[model samples]
Target: MESISPLQFLKDKSILVIGATGFLGKVFAGKILRIQPNVKKLYLVVRAADAKSAMKQILDEVYVSTS
Candidate 1:
């Protein structure tokens, strides 16, 4: 059997990620972003009080992992 990388599992797909702002989810998302920069897009599900806040949380998670 061939081993598939996590990045391969996400190629050319519109991935809908729930809990992307959470700890585990953020790490998973960060790995994808770092390895698969050409992914279609990153859809994040957040439950903050407002859309701005939710988006901020997602962005913070992803960008923080970059450093």
Candidate 2:
């Protein structure tokens, strides 16, 4: 068995992040995007049960900082 960095795992792969609207979740999402912008796309889980809010979170936190 060997260890793999998250960036490596996410390289050219689609990532689905559950509970990614919280404090820690946001951090993980940020790291993935910051290191691997070309990792495909991110699917963030949220309690709002709608794409609008979920998209907002991704845009506000994950995408904003990187840009």
Candidate 3:
């Protein structure tokens, strides 16, 4: 057995995160990036007025102050 690197696993990978605008999802998504910034893509699913607003919500609420 061997230990696998989180970064290695995430590289060039696309992630679909539901409720990413919420607390837990935010933490998870943030940690993923913090641990592996080279992830190919991060797809976040949230409820908002539109695509623009959904992105805004995710940006404004999630992945902030995660250090």
Candidate 4:
């Protein structure tokens, strides 16, 4: 029997994330980053009226703080 580590597979790999503002998407993206901080690139596709709003959504909705 053999087991491949998911983190190892994602390390240094580029990932594209869509609907980053959504619940599942945000959680998935956050998990990926937390698990594999060394990922080559994390491309996020967000829908917004403008770049500013998109940034706000990502910061406020996607990324949150416990403190």
Give the winner by lDDT: 4
- Mind giving the per-residue lDDT tens digits that candidate 2 earns over 1-67? 9999876787889888887767877788888877888887777777666878878877777566545
Ordered list by lDDT, greatest first: 4, 3, 1, 2
Q: Which should have the higher lDDT, number 2 or number 3? A: 3
Q: Which candidate is the best by TM-score?
A: 4
Q: Report how far residue 3 has shifted in candidate 2, in Å.
A: 7.3
Rank candidates, TM-score, best first: 4, 3, 1, 2
- In model 2, residue pairs whose N, Cα or C atoms come closer than 3 Å (at least 3 residues apart or on different chains), thus clashing, are none
- The lowest-lDDT stretch of 10 consecutive residues in candidate 2 is 58-67
* Consecutive 10-residue window with the lowest summed lDDT within model 4: 58-67
lDDT tens readout by residue for model 4, 1-67: 7887998889899999998877788888989988889999998889999999999887887778211
lDDT scores for all predictions? 0.77, 0.77, 0.82, 0.85
Residue-level lDDT of model 1, residues 1-67, one tens digit each, is 9999877877877877788777877787777777888789778788899988877886677567754
TM-score of 2: 0.64
The stretch of ten residues in a row with the least summed lDDT in candidate 1 is 58-67
Residue pairs clashing, model 3: none
Q: What is the lDDT of residue 22 in candidate 4?
A: 79
True lDDT of residue 55, candidate 1: 73
**Worst-scoring 10-residue span by lDDT in model 3:** 58-67
lDDT of 3 by residue, 1-67 (tens): 8988877878999999998877788888889888888888998889888888877776678845454
